[model samples]
Target: MNKWLYRLKHAWAVILGKAKISYVKKGGFSFRDFTYSENEIQFLNSLKIEFLFSEFGEQRVNGGGADFQDKRTRLDPSLTSLRKYFPNAKYTVYSDFDLKIDGVNLIKVNSPVAHPEHPRYGYRTADYFKFLSLTESDADFKCVLDSDMAIVSSDVIALIHLTRKFGFCVPYNDRQLLRQDMIWSQDTQPIEDESLGLGHSYNQSPMTLWKDDERGNVFYKKCAEIMKKDPSRSSLVMWKTAWETGIYPYILPKQWCLCDGNEGLGEEVILHVGHEKIKEYYDQ
Candidate 1:
């Protein structure tokens, strides 16, 4: 199909409040069938879901005059809220230091790149570790949740179901540059200009989901290549590569993972509190 026609069909589906699933043949492989309704929840209860969180035990302090504690201040409460919403779901924490959460598994792993000499050293190391955890974890399906985020809705099962169908999902953030020019169409291709660095648009990775299947394996391998090219900017590279390669299909509905940007948390399931504006909103 022509790219414009594909966009038009998707526009029609959106106008009718219906979901559109498109299959494109590339490298002799075609995407399988998957469907999603606006508010429909399905196939969540039977999935073996696990949540992964990465914290580097840094001493970054917030405006509250206290150390930005990952365990005592952030992860503890975040885990409590997550368990309350998802009682049967398993939890794992990836960190350089040892941690103890009652029912959560702790895995200590070191960063692949020594960041002392990099330009943006110490920036997004935890983000890189989050990607590493995907390869380290044994779960069939994995959802990476930042330590600062809190689960606010019991309907998170809906997100799990969406991930199972879509293969991967990321929350929509208010960053205009990240969202613009990111639509996946037949003609969409990855940017090869190294000078572009992070490229024009990408997913907000504060909270994301991944499956352990073939698609997930390919996605992670690409991410690893990006990290090898530039360790300090792995997060940006992952999104850029995904968009350019058209490997990851779609972004989850905004209601699934809400960020602390311009968008209000009107029916959002997960509340991401990593931004300064959100911290101010919660008076933290």
Candidate 2:
């Protein structure tokens, strides 16, 4: 869909008090369908932080059907809420298309690998761009956020402080299970086993922070190596490497970044609404 027409429809939906917008595949809707308020833009410009998000046009199921018709719609509210919460921060959207949001900057980036298919996770090539951005971004402190979540609190500023002090942070989570033999294979799991001791579990990547210093640069280099080995399994590889390298992520408190309907929605910093079906639970 042409970006302007989608924005028009989105505006109409808001004027009608409808939070959910019906999206049909190829309906000319993009992630920017939910626009930001002028005040929101002003607020974002005031913050000195930078945020990164990535999106692909439309993903198809294994059989080539529209897997989730409302996936983008489900993401709209979260993105809208993030804009409201972090008005002063710089939000950069990385995608193949040039996206425009009132308070967001869109950067056109190419996939690092051909077909960038995750062998095990089935994620699209676009999903791996965050790693590239982490390495190349000039921001002193950069945050990569999933489109499926919203920041419900200003504690993110505190989180940034913590990341700056620790060198890196990800939503505290468990170590990913990997095959024993695959542990040493870059094509399977890229990080050296020694690095896994930093943390035994994979910090969920739904929300993560990276600093632009020595530690942060090392993390980015590791991520790049892992992605080159297996673009499709980059997330898993990252978790594995972080654990093996003893570069475990500083886990964010649950109250700060809850996922899958953990609770305390009113006080949490972020709510990661997993998928369309799960999002309905929160929508209610």
Model 2 over residues 1-284: C-alpha lDDT tens digits? 47588567657767877534432222232121233345434544554567777665544332112133454442354567655646556678777665666666778766665444445332434446666666666766677766666554443455665776777676644233444324533335344554443433433344445545665566656766666555635546566556546565566666554554454334455655544333454451
Question: What RMSD value applies to candidate 2?
Answer: 11.4
Best by TM-score: 1
Highest-scoring model, lDDT: 1
Residue-level lDDT of model 1, residues 160-274, one tens digit each, is 5566677666555444243233342221334455534343343444444455566666676667566655553443566666765767635665555455454454544555555
The TM-score obtained by model 1 is: 0.67
lDDT of 2: 0.54
How many residue pairs clash in model 1?
Answer: 1
Which portions of model 2 miss their true places by more than 4 Å? 1-47, 59-75, 114-124, 174-199, 203-207, 243-246, 264-267, 276-278
What lDDT is reached at residue 36 by model 2?
Answer: 38
For model 2, what is the error of residue 84's alpha carbon versus the real structure, in angstroms, after optimal superposition? 1.7
